[model samples]
Target: MEVRRRDPCQSVQNFSSSSAPYHTIFVFLIPLLVGVIEINNVQNRSKSLIETHLMSMCLFLLAILIYAFAYFAAMKSELQVFKAIEMISGSLCSVSLVSIILPRPYGHFSFIIWAFVLLLVAYKESFHMKIWQFWNRFGGNNQQLLPTKCVVGCPAYP
Candidate 1:
């Protein structure tokens, strides 16, 4: 009688390839459906600015939770890239959420400013450029792209 053992690397490769499709649907499609439902609910309701901001923050938290779950559940080495993207997304969400503490005008303006910063970061990452290089290419001088202190310094509404 002869005994044989399966190759460990082969088993891992097979598992990852087989599970990729299921992970794709779980990590991508489910969150997309959640987003659609959230948008629909928001549109159908008459919420105040604070309520809307809270809802937005909740959504971002939900997304981060989903991605975190996916990151842990994923077996493929390639799926690790989600971690970096997830962190960036969280930072962008936090930036917008910070505006909720400020007065109405400043809060709204801060949201716009942070959204632009998010765009800049996305552009820089997509083009594989350093942040300073991105600023240089886009004609920004000395990296003072926007007055971010306004968000921190603005007084809260009474």
Candidate 2:
């Protein structure tokens, strides 16, 4: 009698591919549910927008990371990349939740900055680009583009 041994990697690949659809559905449904709950509970409509935006951004990033991870797993390559994506997604989700809970940080400016940093980190990791390269591309390498004076002048500035 011959016993066949199933390869663990093969099982994981199968599971990841097979579960992709469910993951997609779960990702899409989460924002809708959270938005409804937040809308009802939040007294200030303006503040709710910031919380919803951060949550949606985190979910969007997670969806992209999961899609990329599943694609690579199916191809049987980039296991290390999968791990990196997993870590970033976990951290991004945690930060987003924390920002929501502490909603008054610098009048939500800090949350926006935090979300931007998470995005920048994810972009840097995925594409192996330096932070300066990204800023130069989008920010045009202008020293005065952000204008520290305005940030410092804001009432919320500490």
| Best TM-score among the predictions, by candidate number | 1
- Candidate 1's clash total is 0
Each prediction's Cα lDDT score?
A: 0.51, 0.50
> How many Å off is the CA of 153 in candidate 2?
75
TM-score of 2: 0.33
- Pull out the clashing pairs in model 2: none
Q: What TM-score, to 2 decimals, does candidate 1 have?
A: 0.36
Tens digits of per-residue lDDT, candidate 1, 6-46, equal: 54445445343333333433455445545654665675567
lDDT of 2 by residue, 48-108 (tens): 5445666545565675566556545644654555544544454444444444545455425
